[model samples]
Target: MFSKLVNPKSIAVIGASHNPAKIGYVVLKNLVSHNFKGDVYPVNPKGGEILGYRVYKNVEDLPEVDLAVITLPAELTLKVFEDTAKKAKFIIPIAGGFGETGKKGKEMEKYILEKAREHNARIVGPNTVGIYIPSTGVNTALVVPERSRFPGDGDIAFITQSGALGLLTMDSVSLYNVGFSAFINLGNRVDVNENELLEYFGKDEKSKVIIMYIESFKDGKEFMKIASQVTRKKPVVVLKAGRTSRGGKAASLHTGALGGNDAVADGAFKQVGVIRAYDEVELVDYARALAYGKPIMGDRIAVVTSAGGVGVVTTDYIESKEHGIGMKMASLDEKTKRKIKDEVVPFASVENPIDMTAQASDDDYDGVLEALQSDPNVDAILVYALFQTPLISEKLVDIITKWHRKGSKPLIVGSIGSNFTMKMAAKFEENKVPVYMSIERAVKAIKVLRIRGKYIERWENE
Candidate 1:
């Protein structure tokens, strides 16, 4: 099923056209632009030719097609599917107004399902953006931009219920120069749902982290079962929508999904060791961190900062004990405290949330980082603002880059100002250190990494 759907050697766009703004046209353009290595045929009743390729009147006229992408209207979608089923083994329907609408939609969905069974074919979505397989260079999305290229091969595989939202997230990650293994938009999931996809990606060698944006669940028990087993092996981060009653109802109409009890879903995810993201930005943050950063071993965090307020905020979040098992600020041992006092100025406070004060120099920052990194109790270290001044920022970047190259523990940085901070951020990114704009984001990222790391350890041991 996966090979025929994702690695197909030949494909047909059922509603292909020459109009650049049309969905079919964009799909064709994306394929050609991305240099997809496959036989592509355009099939449309009104089509003559598109992008120098001859267009067939219907799918039946195509010589050979392993996969068919239907970009026609709701009324004509089933007929297109039936025609394509004769030659293709997999069909991706990108139209709306299916089971998501109401009774009429359900009837329409039933017709498609019945026909698919008779033809021994599988359907991706009745309402979906489409799919992207980077390794195979197969892009089935109808809304892909003309300039869109296949994202680089990475360990993260993204699956989302909202087609547009999935594409937006993919674009955002690409801007950060992050790539993905594959992306699946499961809009109004009729034949293929989240559980099936999760199971598939769990065993996929190319996928190390699985990210999902879900509006509803079809089988809560089954989803929890698979999610628990999969997350034990790899990190699974979910951004679950429809928390409120109104939102749940809207979600149902949007994807023909059962939003179910929000609280129950939350508990289920937790029980299965899944990390739930509160918002879209956090979802990407968690996904990216898991993809790039090493997993944190414990919750005992040490804050080494030149910005006292930022250090305080980091302490507040780490000590709040709000996340999974609630992390705490590890106390500095007497030896480490003495080292900080000896290395730092007399006025500096030598505590767990060590405030090096504004007078901290390059040597002071290095001393504090070295002290924290050497401490046995400190599982993770948060470095805040070594670049308060121009001279200091440059020196701080040098120090951080050197230490980061040799560091084993997870080190996060929070910049104080925009201009200097941005440069420091780029350096830290180059050095492969994850930097955050706020202490809250840093703490959240740490929490997720720790939880996922524990799950991986347990799974490996089992």
Candidate 2:
């Protein structure tokens, strides 16, 4: 089911063009720019050159390709698909005015479904921006390359019902350099839905985490069934939209989603082990943590900080009732205290929020982390290093990265500082430790790890 669409060996842009204004130009340009390692053919009746490639008059004139991207009018897209369905294994229509509009649109969608079945072909969307697969050099997004630069390849395969959400997430976190295995916009999903995608990505070797922004599921029960199995292999994070007071109507218009009862959806997601993200930040944060950090084996957390106040705030959030994360501030064992006291300054605290204060050296942090690694009570570590400290050196990056690769427990870096600190934070991130500017954000990432751990524990018990 996923062969040609996700990993096509060759592609034909049905409405490929030389004009800078058209979607066809962007599609063909992106395919060529991204250095798609497969055969790319530009299909257009105008028969002109686009980005150094000759434009074929039609699919019949071009060599058979695995996939075809039709960027024509809604009605015209159908006619093109009717011809290409016999040749192309997969097709994507990047035009709107489908079922989301009205009755006529629905009829168009129905015809697409019938053609797909008749030809044993598949369609990605009737109204979609497109998908991005970085590893395979498949950039099907409509945005011009000059305006938008993509994130490098990583493990999180993110799919959004709203292409805008996917683009916004990519743009906002460009500095953090959050990478992905793929980015898909499933607008007005005429054929391919979450069920199909989850199954494909669940077994995907490159995808360690799968994140999504879904307004509604075409088949809620089927999604749950597949999601339960998928979550058992890799983490699945969802930002289910339209759960608010006006969510139903808003969702209907946005993606034609039903926006079913919020409570039922919540319970179903929980039962199936899907992590629900409340907002955009959590959506990215949860995915980053799950992808970078290991699952927490327990709720006990070791908070290490250069500032005492931030550590207290972080601990408070973890235990606070409103947060509802089943977490406990860890009590350091005798050996951990002894090691910290020996390496750290005399004034530093060796307990839970191991406050190594301003004068603490890089070794002090590493010593404590090293001690915590062996401790039975600790299951996670939260680091808050304020880089303004004179003694905080680049050596800390090595220590953080070293322990993160240990993979025994989840490790998160929480810092609140200026531009210089962000630069320092990027070092930890490059080595696979997620860094957050706020104490709340750091704790939220830890909370996600704990939540994932609890779900895993439940599965083990079952």
Candidate 3:
């Protein structure tokens, strides 16, 4: 299923249009602009021409097409699918009236499914944004048509049920410079669900991490079966919606989704070793951290920082009453503590959360990081600084690069100032160190990393 969708040699766009604002036009534009290495036929009855390419009146008119993208209206979409079945083996229905709309829409969806089964055709969506494969330069997203040109190539495959949310999440995470192997928006998933994608990504050598934003699950037992197997091989992070009573009700009305009991899903996810995220922000947070951050061997976290307040906040969250993890603060040894006191100002605190004070120099920063990196008690280290301090930024980059070269443990940075922080954030990213704007985010990243490590440890023991 994935091979045909990802490696189509020829494709046809139904309901092709000339107007750039329409979804049909943007879909065609993205495919053409991204240099898709295949033949593209635009199908439209009223179309004279589009983007200098000749348009065929219908799918029957096209000579050969392996995949067909249907962008026609809901009422007329079935006819298009019937016509496309004769020529194409795969169909991506981008129209939005199926199951999401009410009773009539459900009937239409049933009809579409019957037609697809009759012709042995596979459908991607009836209400989906589409798919993107950066390596092959094939983008089928309706929103953000220009994202096809964005130089994104990484080992994470993301699948989301919400089309708009999926694209927005991609754009948001791309700001941190993380690339994706593939992005799939599975709207009103009539046939393809999270389990199939999970299995595919598990076997895909190009994918190292799998991230999903799911509103509901069709087959709970099947999802757990595949998710357990996949997480044992690679990390799987999920942001499950329809948790709250109100949200669950909204989910049912939104996509006719069956919102299962939140407690059951929670226990199921945990039993299968699936890392569940509380929100969308945490989903991406865990994705970036697990995708790039190194593994944590223990739960002893040491924080080194120039800002005392931020360090205190991070420590509070790391040991918060809400977190159930059994991580403890690893105190520095007497010798290391003594060295910090002797090498630095008398005002600096030499505790687990080392506050270097504002007067600390670049040498002081490097010294603290090196001490933490060498400390046997420290399983992971978090560094906090304001990006306006150029010396601190440069020193951080140098120290991180050096430690990374020496096989350092997970080192997380919490930067201040939105603008300057973004600049240094890119530097941390280049050095393979995850950076967070908030202390809470740093703690959450570490928490998920710890969870993944625990899961891996269990699997290895088994």
Candidate 4:
């Protein structure tokens, strides 16, 4: 059903315009800038040229295309949809004021869905920012390139109900060296909904992990059924909005989504093996861990940090039961402890969280990580490589990267600072090492991996 939407052979912009402020103009610019390989047809009554492509005066005159992007008002979209319904296989209407507006808007949404069924065409939204597939260079998003950034081609497929929030969240995580296979914005959800897309992306080869920011499930039971099946193969993380009664009312007004009981939804999420994220940070953190880090097979974790304070707090997080994902500090082998203590200064802590102290050098981390990776008792390792120290250099990035690439076990790093620290963090991520800004986030990421691993382990044993 989403074949054309995923990889359209040809696209037609129905309301193509020359105005820089118009959404149509930005859509065309994105396609051209992203280097879309397919043919592009601009449809406008003006019958002129836009970005070097000739504009068709009418949709009827243009050849049948795989996708049609309607960038007009809700009322105007219906007239254009009537023309493109027979010509295009997939339609995207990027306009607001549809079902979210009230009774008149709901009627319009009903009409569009009826027409879509009649023509055997699928619609993405009547009020959406549209989709972005990095691999195919298909970017129909409404974001200004100057203000926001888009991720490169990667393993995560992100789906969201709110377009603006989706784009903003995508931008927020873009700097973390994570890439996206696709970005789908389901605006009012006139026709295409989350359950169908979840099933579609489940089979998508490029999407190793599927993440969503959902305001409400169009069909709760249907979603649970599909998500349960998908979770067996790959990780699915969701940040369900409208958890509070007041928040639910706001969600309805924002996107016409009817809110449900949060307690019931939480139970359903766990039943289906869906990892629930409470905020935007957890959403991306879990995704980064699942997408890049190795599967954690057990709950025992070893922490190696230069700062004693960081290691102490991280220990607290590991043993904390409030988060519900149980984990504990690994007891290192006597030989492993002796080796690490010998490699570093004699005073360096060789216990669970091996605090090498600020005086420890890059070589110290390199050797200690190797010891931890070889220890049979350690299921995962969290290292805090604070760059502000006198002995730690940028070379620590390469050392950590080499250890991570070995894939000996699940590894995550925590480095909290401003400019220089974030720079190294990005480098750590570029080398495929998951680095968190704080100890709490890194610990949470470890739990996420543990949850996903337990699911896989259960399925395998069954």
Candidate 5:
């Protein structure tokens, strides 16, 4: 069912329009313009051509397609679903004011759901932005691709509940050239929810890492079971919303989910080996680390930095036990220390948080990184590649990228600066080394990887 939703060869746009401002028109336009190699049939009450496709007067008159996307008012969506469900392989409703509204809206959503079951047609959403599969060029989002470009194909599969937020994250992620394999928003999931998609995408060949932005779990026990099984295979990172009473109210209003106690959610996630992210930034950070970088074997992390301040701050993050994450600054073995001393300047610190000073060049980073990679005591490598250093040019990106591709040890790069540095940072991302703008942010990603390592250990024991 999920495969049909993501891989439809022909799709009928039930509310397709020519108007540029309306969502129905925008979704059709994005799908058509974004190069979806499917036949697009536009249906509207008024029989007229929309974007050159002859519009069918009603859903009943539409030709059979692999998917039907409904962009009508909440009250009108059900009747359309009834007419099209039997003919279409999948149906997606793209409107809110359903279960999230109130008791009356719930009744309406229930009716639409019954029609789906009656026809045995799978549903994607009743209030979603739509599904995005860049590999197949299927983008069902209500927004256009001009202002917010779709992500290129990559190994991460992201799912979200909020339509607006999902689009924003996709647009932001694209700016850094970090792409996604597929993105689906489970809006007011009348029938299709995260569980089905999780199991389907868990085995997806293109998706190496799975990420989610969930307001609430539809089936808590089932989710926990599936999550535990999936995490042993690949990393699953989530950003659960509505932690506070005020936020809980908003979340409930947003998705009709009874946001429960935050502490229980946190504990359940940890037990299942699922990593939790607090915000959008953390969500993307964890996703990037899991998708591109190697598993953080242990919390004994070594920091090599051209900036002493960056080294100190990052070391603090590693030592601090935030949320019971027990991490330590790695102790460099003598062999590693001797190699670092011989390669770096004599004034450079040979201990943990190895500061090579501002005068450090690309050669200094190359030497220190090699030593850390060889040390059995150092489980992970964090390099603060301050691009401001005169001698450190574009060459540093390749050096870090090389170690990452070699797959001997996990190497994380940290470089914080203005736009100039961001361009340099994108180079590292392009090569898949996973560089971050801040030491704290960089260390947070490493923490998530370490947490996954611990839970994977439990799986191996079992």
Candidate 6:
């Protein structure tokens, strides 16, 4: 159903414009700038040429377009949609004066949906920023290319109900070198909704993790049903807004729908094995860890750190179940302890959170991680790689990355400092090794991995 929308061979920008201020111009520019590997058709009544692509005089004059982006006013958008519906398989109307506006707007939205059904066509939104696929270079998002950055092609597929938030996230996450397979903004959700997209991405081979930011669901039961099936195959993480009555009222104003009961939603999510995130950071952090790190089969974690203070805090977070992230510190194997002791100074602590002291070198990490990986008690490893230490160089990034790729156990790294620490953390993340700036966040990521592992265990047993 989403093949045309996801990988259209031909696309038409119905309201293509020469004016840089208009969204039509930016939408067309994004497609052209990305060098989309498909035929691009630009349509406008006053068309001459836009960014070198010949603009068609009208939608009626264009050939069969797999996707049509209508960037006009609500009334004109309906007219343009009627024309494009005759030939286009999918349409994305990037106008906001729809159901969210009031009575008249809701009627207009109903008309568009009715016509869409008759033509056997699907609509992404009457109010939306649209979609972006890095692999195909198809960017329909109405954001300036220079200012709003985009992620490279990677595993996570992000779906958001809010266009601005979705774009902001894509831009922000790019700074960490976290890439995406695709981005979809389900603006207004006129025809397509989150449940359908969840199932779609679940079967998508390119999408290793599916993350969503939603305020309301079109069908709560349907979403739970889809999520249950999807989670069995690939992890699904959702950051649901509107947990309070005041928030629900705000959500209704924003999306033209009442927010579902958060208490019931929470139960449904947990029962379906859907991982829940409360904030934007947790959403991305959870998805990134699930996409790159292995599922933590057991709760035992072996923490290797250069800084003693970091190790201590990490232990506190792991040992405490206050926030439901209770994980055990791995009981170091006798041989593992011996190897760690040999690698570091005699004064170094050889316990669960092996504090190699500030004097520990990169080689010490390499040896300690290797030993921990072979330890039967260690189901996961968290490294406190403080880069400021004189002995720990940039080489530790590669050392951690190597152990991560081995896939013996899930590996997570936590580092907190200034620019130097952040730079090293970014490097580790770029290598597909999960890195968090705080010990708490890193522990939370491990908690997500454990959630995934438990789901897999339950599914297999069934």
- Please, what are the lDDT tens digits per residue for candidate 6 over residues 261-289? 57777888989999999988899899989
The digit string of per-residue lDDT tens for model 2 on 396-462 reads 8888888888847689888788788787776776776888878888988998988898899999999
lDDT of 1 by residue, 338-444 (tens): 87788655567788688767777887778777776678887877777656543364778777656655776677666656765766665665555666666777788
lDDT of every predicted structure (CA atoms): 0.77, 0.84, 0.79, 0.88, 0.82, 0.88
Please list the residue runs of candidate 1 whose C-alpha ends up more than 4 Å from where it truly belongs after superposition.
46-48, 134-136, 142-153, 173-175, 243-261, 321-326, 334-350, 355-371, 385-388, 392-406, 416-433, 453-462
**Which pairs clash in the backbone of model 3?**
none
The TM-score obtained by model 6 is 0.94
Clashing pairs in model 6, backbone N/Cα/C closer than 3 A: none
Could you give the candidate ranking by lDDT, starting with the highest?
4, 6, 2, 5, 3, 1
Question: Tens-digit lDDT track for model 5 on 354-391?
Answer: 99998788888777887777899988888887888788
Colliding pairs, model 2: none
Q: Where does candidate 3 stray beyond 4 Å?
A: 144-151, 243-261, 323-326, 338-348, 361-363
Candidate ranking (TM-score, best to worst): 6, 4, 2, 5, 3, 1
Q: What is the C-alpha RMSD of each candidate to the true structure, in Å?
A: 5.3, 4.1, 4.6, 4.2, 4.4, 4.0
Error of 4 at 412 (Å): 1.2
Using Cα atoms with residue i matched to residue i, what is each candidate's TM-score against the true structure?
Answer: 0.83, 0.93, 0.89, 0.94, 0.92, 0.94
Q: Give the residue spans of candidate 2 off by over 4 A.
A: 244-260, 323-326
Q: After superposition, how far is residue 98 of candidate 4 from its true place, in Å?
A: 1.3
By summed lDDT, the worst window of 10 consecutive residues in model 3 runs over 252-261
Residues forming the 10-long window of minimal summed lDDT in candidate 2: 252-261
